[model samples]
Target: MEEKPFLGLRTVIYAAPDLSATKAWYAKALAIEPYFDEPFYVGFNVGGYELGLIPDASIVEGSTVSYWGVADIDKVIQRFLNLGASIHTDIQDVGDGIKTASIKDPFGNVVGLIENPHFSL
Candidate 1:
């Protein structure tokens, strides 16, 4: 049999028209500073994954969602709302006790949060 061709998810990049503002917002939302900060890009280490920001002229939320694992989906959603993010999707259980949600960041990026009882490293 052929081996699976894909490795695990490494990064999710959000286009930031206003790089500084987006960077600051993400710092508070994720509660972490960027390990790599530069004019071209800012990268945060989020749970062994990379959350990256790049300067762009146009920003739009795409249909694709990358759900980050969370212990408390409600709390995280509330925190993001408090940080000026609007709700893209409220928390809902998909199945088997797995709750999921998505929020639109200030820069027009959809950030997803998931509480999966089965998820583990």
Candidate 2:
């Protein structure tokens, strides 16, 4: 077999203008505290994946959007909205029973969610 070039997504980092505020927001949103915290970065272990937040004052607009797998996209989207995330993209079936949605987090980062019947951990 050819060497597998792509393993999988390991970590997704978001720029945090206010590190403390962003860290607290994600902690409450994910319902899991960060495993690593410092003035430079904060890391959260989300279902074997890493979500990192880094302090940067000059971060630009439109950073990379990483979709987290979820069982129910609607429910998760609602929860995120309740937690003060604005909808960046409404829930929609992209194709083949895969649904995706995105939101602008309170800290101005795009948070995406996906529900794929074909994917399993």
Candidate 3:
């Protein structure tokens, strides 16, 4: 099956160091309240999806950066690669109109860039 290459950033999880600080930062910056209320997990309902912010000092190896989505997956990947973003994984067709590529930012955090072309991710 041909990979349905599209960009729909459905969901993302951020492993912040300080939960309170991260939550406050996002709430102030974006002006949105988190829908999912929990002591450990913070879920921010924004747009049509939710951004899960979990404070984990160890995630994908102490990395804390997650990408949302991009219109052109390859182009977006290229842009990051050109800017010295070491690609951890090449673009892979997972299935069901979902394509993903992961890269390690300069801060040692792996940020996955996704593009869902076929359906609304």
- Could you say which candidate leads in lDDT? 2
lDDT (10s digit) by residue, model 2, range 1-121: 8999999999988889899999999999999999999998899999999999988745545667889999989988888889999999988999999999999899888888999999997
The TM-scores, one per candidate, come to 0.93, 0.91, 0.46
Over 16-43, each residue of candidate 1 has an lDDT whose tens digit, in order, gives 8889999999999999999999998999
| lDDT to native, each model | 0.90, 0.90, 0.69
Model 3 residue 68 lDDT score: 55
Model 2 accuracy (lDDT, Cα): 0.90
Candidate order, TM-score descending: 1, 2, 3
Top model number, TM-score: 1
Candidate 1 off by > 4 Å? 57-63
Q: After superposition, how far is residue 57 of candidate 3 from its true place, in Å?
A: 7.0
Model 3 C-alpha RMSD to native: 8.3
Better of 1 and 3 by TM-score: 1
